[model samples]
Target: MILPFILVLALFDFDNVLLWTHEISLVSHKIWFCDAIDIFYYLNTRLFLLFFYFYCLLPPSTQPQRKNSNSKMATLAKLLSSICVCVIVMLTTKAVEATPTYTATHCTNTTTYAPNSTFQTNLDILLYYFSNNISQSNGYFLGITGFNSVNAVGGLFLCRGDVATTVCNQCLTTAIKEIRQHCPNQTEALIWYDECLVHYTNRYFAVDKIDPRVNLNDGNIVSSVDLGRFNQSLHGLLNDLATEASGSSESKKFAAGEVVVTESMTVYGLMQCTNDLTNSECGTCLKNAIGTIPNGKQGARALLPSCNVRYQLYPFFTSSSPSSSGGMKLGPGTIAVVVVVPIFFLIILFLGCYYFKRRSKKKILLPSIMENFGDEFPTLESLQFNLATLEAATNQFSLANKIGSGGFGEVYKGVLLDSRQIAVKKLSKTSGQGTIEFKNEIVLIAKLQHRNLVTLYGFCSEEQEKMLVYEYVLNKSLDYFLFDPHKERVLSWRERYNIIGGIARGIHYLHDQSRLKVIHRDLKPSNILLDKNMNPKISDFGMAKMIDIDEHQGNTKRIAGTYGYMSSEYAMHGHYSEKSDVFSFGVIIIEIISAKRNALSLHSLDFDDLLSYAWKNWRDEKSLEILDSNIEKSYSYIEVIRCIQIGLLCVQQNPDDRPTMERIVSYLSNVSVELPLPQEPGGFMGNRTNQIPRDNISDQRNNSNTTGSSVNDITMNNSFPR
Candidate 1:
């Protein structure tokens, strides 16, 4: 075609032939070619063909043989057609090579290496190891190579939660091959397939990374009669799955389940994390992933380095081996007669009846609960546990089950009949204030729901006994880790930073998102529970207060809270607010960073308290020094300094000087935000001469003489009585 077009242009004029030839060359080179080099190759080949036709078949200077010219033109057309067919075949093959089963890929553009370079060589070995060895396991593998940090390569691959060994192996093989092809010489790469994910990096990346995640929506809108109900059910199902998946063993961190969105509809969900991540890390990653789910979508998935979560109206995961019809494949007649048509409605009826029955019981308990307290009561009857059941679960309040005790009472580790674990807080009958606080905790936590907050399983109130059942956190409290010299090593700077963020999110939920505006009166390290994965959940709401959503502050005549964590106004004049929680959060932040208690003895003359020490360091521009030595060089320097400044801001003597939970969250999340200088914190007694005993100071604020400190208030010195 090009040869004929050039000949026609030449018949018009030699200049016209040259102009048309240049125009075709320019367009074809720019639009048809893949690269500059490819364009040059295409242009040179086309030009050569044109040169051969003009010079050999029919010269422009002398053209007389008509029959010969016609034959040559016919031959040129056949040759060009053959070339076009070959080019199309080659392009198709390249496209096929590029396509993979994976949904997304992350190849680092910032870092690339030469072919067969040291880093590339190490990466290739790691990839080969993963591809060959990952399939040998149930569904997980981690590999590392290189003798030094610079040349080191660490990578991991995880199959979807419910896939079998064979399917996992196949997916792993595909992922390994595809990632290497996609990333080529890049030092870092990640690829996610529906069945598995593969990741590799030069730096150590076994720890959880929340940001730089991939979010995908199926784009199919949920045609639900009640969108709100569907969303609620979806989130609830995902949350439950996250909890289950995060708590899974190190070898397998995966969970999948289905929840009824309505009487006739069900949403299937799945959550999984890299086996190497801690339960808390998995939980955090899943929670972050869940948060990114866009509204009005019927199905969505978010993939992070450590964890991923997915929810869909249709089943996307295989329950058994992939060979078994790939997924939950069902026939139309079977589906209509069985699960969806008949059983679904029956399940809804059963659940509705059960819900109403529980609600009725809660109503019965409400009057009794409010009779003496004379305050508004939340719906607590549903959370009620049988007194006998709890007694049995805790071995009739046996000494062997007791975990800790405080102003509220003793906490016992209890196992329910179904094998579920719980932390049972039995309020002391001797302490009248404990009863009030118990009532307070029941109302506050029942209405609040956040991943960072400890779950209130149920309560038991029968005769003289009142007990609160909470989801048992396996690793106990942050203080157990932060205060113990030997255990402190486990609390890495990354983990500590995560804990700080989790605590911040929990408090923010209490202040802003919860149905009630709550102030967690005792926000301290001991009050923060760490799950198996070292994720922090704020607990002990016994001292918490509930106020109107519009109300900014509250005044309490009976100030009952820990000394070091209490804000100045709340401690000195019984004034409390969300800002008060912020102050305690500040103190907790300093403790988390420094691994030092705020109530440290001043006898050493080094520092009066954690706050004073933090403030001094920040003022001196030596904020990094305030970080716990256990963290060493692993910490993000800017994040540590920002936290220090934020902590100081929260503990400022004047309540007005403090940032709200909303602002604090923004500050913590956005690194670009500039922070104002912090004023001196409360109880900044400067030196040993002015330092006061925290116990005396606390006693002065609340002289109720509660028999024992709260379970959280019990330091290592306070041993449990046998």
Candidate 2:
């Protein structure tokens, strides 16, 4: 074909028609004349080629030339039409792909209910309300109904961080209707759309949840060239977004950003959570979501009830106008290589060798010892402190600087270069915590933020040393005042009441408000610290366990908590949950009221424990006996009685009978709410009969002794108060 076209041009040039020179000036110079010549020239060439090729294939037959010409023309026309149709289809498909599509839907099978059941009705109503609120207001809303009824429904919804309010509302409204169709009459359902999420249940749904989660992988693996570098950039980008989003205000918890993955490619990411969740909750939720992102996937999304995380190669978040300030966005820029390639590799090699050497020495790997610790805290480098700085502040951890000790480490009061007073927890060399607990306290407490919770400033790990830095509480722990005869007398009724409410709010943060649902297994009076103002701050989370917000309870073989504070089921069978924390809180409340330890024997020989003694006195209509004699006689009798009633309800033998932290906070703040009658306390009279040898008991009070392995630790069942 090339040769023939060249020959035609050569023939035109030989005839002096190529340049339309003076010899061709005699011909009309109309534009249509040239066009006609160009068309005829190409058609004549093609016709000649076709005729020659067919002639070579066919026998020299006498009269079929005209018929063959018509057939060839028809074949050419059909091919051109097919090409046009394919182009049209391709354009249409690309248009559809540009729009968002529903990702997934998860409907729990265990929560199946009747079509018209009260629970289902409540769920529908609540979802509708959420939809309405989301449509009219911003892109996030939480709805909860039927507080005390059997058909209680609690839920929340969130839209993409960068989506427009109108689009978010439309997405949520569509999801609400679609969820019902997909999981008809289900008591609990969670549905996800590309733009928003719709979730509701018959029970209260807290922010941190992992189950029924949906993981969507784009399945496009990254290219091997620069794969490691790309992954490193992607992770750094997502982690920054997660932190920023979680730390955002309750009104808007969303972040979006992009990172230069390669010279020609950029990775985009977006993270968002329901505004109802706390900063820590949002962080934890996003961390969990990010953890579920499939390895090597170019694009992916992990959806949960409270949060959503996504990453892709192309920009998916809509650009917001300057007025909206809709979401956090990472500014575009090239990621500078801070470390040399060879040096980076050497660092990794050294770290790997160090880790292996520790393992060879029988030291537990931090990740191996704690389940889900990585998910709870994905990065700790930002919070790490220098051991040298801490030593200088604490005067080389001298005995003079020693303020307290606990099952995990020794506490030393330190003064920073800036004259900031801080408490340093130096992990004992032979302590059972090792790397796991040392990391746990740092990760967990650093994320939790509440006025009633001790603040974690930072942590240190250097030269075979691990220490946690905390804000020092000047007034010491609650036991300093509550148990001492002289100090106990100074704790007036007002102070005691304030202390109780503070403790309740702190525990409430742990159980419900914080990013993760945590059970502080050891909730004794000594574990509560007092500020300069005598306000209580919950401390010592070494024995704490983080669970899913929706989880009812958990079990462990090793029980590590105060005997009097441990619930009956937890003490004997290792069963625990938020309810276990409630039971412990109940014991603390009783101790606070009476100024007497729950496990210690009282003057009366009729009861073996304070729980039993408190129950007997309350049953006999002598609730005043449960109050501390140190309290002024002019105290509010109604408030004291109500507190006693609530404390008993919390100590119910059945964990289910115990009220939640939310309800406990309400009970403490609102006196008009009627308290339920107390049931027999857990392990009321069975302690004496089931008492184990006291020799195995190890006292953790006043921060004494370092914690050992969970299974090796002294069981609380064998440890009773003297």
Candidate 3:
């Protein structure tokens, strides 16, 4: 009995002493040991002690004062022994119960390695290999029997002896799956199962070294009253554990101990390393781990080079007495020599490299192109153009030089000193427009470089002044002839067809082919300027959107566009798309064919709007009746019908039903293609009071003035002379 008691004490002392050593080493390293190894060590030692004590007290012959005692005393002793045995058995049973389980029959394995590799690529391969080799019939037996070693290098190993083999295998399998999933790219990784151990590495890992980088910190904050004392005690305890754990032998390099805080409370600690490490290496590892703790933290832990250390406010390990047969033995003066020197050098090297790399990469100045602009539209260098040079170019804003007038100002035709003819748009002094409009015109037009679009020459912005210069157009615009009666005779059918095609191509470029897909929200006849060759150039992209290809439509409440040409979706619902431009183009096409305005009037000799007139004519197969009188003699009947059909197709009620620019161009080029019937046009049933807004009135007037020579009567406007 005494021998067993002594053995139990020695075993307890061995673990306790190791734990003390680890605690001391942890304090030195400023690291905590709240890792898995520390938890396992603490639990294993307590359970062993409790089991040992109960086992020693079990035999009747071993009991003291057995023969001299009365029957009652003997009976009482027997009952006490039985109860102790039962308690120990129950504890062992519960410990096994606490461990997780795995069924070997469910284990699956697959080959994941390449033909040349020695190691398996994943956990499935390992399982497959074991399953095929170990069990041919009912799978491998489970419970404790499942954990025995099959091979020296790669075999099943159990950390908890009481765990069932089925449970151990299950735990190991789960751990293996988790590690593979989380760390798929890593060549080496490890995971701990409650009942078993699963680890794989590219190279063999030393089982004894507790890697110090993986320390765990308790998340709970320490209370102010006990913070200082708890920290001090924790530090002292962890350092001691680290020192003792590092000095442990090959069979076991683990320890558990406790330190009293108040009368009822004690802080328990545990420390450990893998058994493969040398005593010196273990000590060094623990010493490094101990130095990581700060002053006021509670429930801390550290994983060291050779061991791990942990301290907690409650006892988290199972308690059992140790067996009488064996206890670990250590030589005298072994602990002190194993710990001191190597730990001091590693700390110095780690901190130096961390701070040096952070200071080398940072920025200083802006790049060159942005610096030359002076962050404004008109720089000091650009304002150098003299007022005399401007006066000479514009002929002192003479009536002959004046081309047009707008809400903002009057436009004048000018010839620069270099003989470059330019259209100078000089702002009126009382103009409500501001510098923002000037900037917008400059920025928007300068970036647009399409062949069918007008080019911006330059701008003058000096001394509260603003002016925009553009390339001069010889023929005023399409509206000058298209909207006029007698002058419409000059525009042949061929010329009108050419103008329509040019406008479509220009709009196509704006909607898709340009660098930015733009929606020209305000396309009108006036906005289409005619060049010397009479080719139509679409202009005024100030209200255009640079849309992404993936986006379908956008909405805005701040509407800015001409009224008759605007799509119903855009006008009523605030939605705009590339198809909105298609709708506008349809209106333009009808206007070009009929040579008439879109406004509603009783004396117009047609329905309210061009869309309604066209739709009614097409349904009655009298589309050619709406053709302009000037082009009636020259236009082909088939071609006219084709144009009318296309116009109706473009004005479909549904935006999606409208043909894309590519499709429209194809339809126009191929006269034999069959066309689908048109649906009811948008805005077909609106109230008469809801006329296209006044903002759009200017666009109509401008169109009439520009195209007056080709459509309307050739009354020479005072703005620009032929």
Best by lDDT: 1
- In model 3, which regions exceed 4 Å deviation? 1-388, 432-437, 485-489, 600-607, 684-722
lDDT of 1 by residue, 1-722 (tens): 57655553443342322211111222123211133233333334434444455555444323444457666555544444444443344334333232325788887888788874556656755665575577466788876766454777788888887765666777788888888788788888889998889998887774446565788998778775768888888878888998999898657888898888777677889998888888988888888888888987878988887788888877666554222112234466644444343234335434545565566677886676676335534455677887866765566677767777665567887655444668888878876766776777777777778889988887877877888888888776787777765563467888888898899999999999888888888887777888877788888787788889899999887667765677667766688899889988998888888887775332346654678878887888888777777687687888888988999999998889999999999999999999999998875334455444454343322222322233336432221211
Name the better of 1 and 3 by lDDT.
1
Q: For residues 326-411, write the lDDT of model 3, one tens digit per residue.
A: 23333444332233222232233234333332222211122221332336434333433445445555666677667776545667
Write out the backbone clash pairs for model 2.
281-515, 405-703, 406-703, 407-706, 407-707
Model 2, residue 399: C-alpha shift (Å) = 1.8
Candidate achieving higher TM-score, 2 or 3: 2
lDDT, model 2, position 304: 86
- Clashing residue pairs in all predictions, respectively, total 7, 5, 89
Sort every candidate by TM-score, greatest first: 1, 2, 3
RMSD of each: 32.9, 28.7, 32.4
Residue-level lDDT for 219 in candidate 2? 70
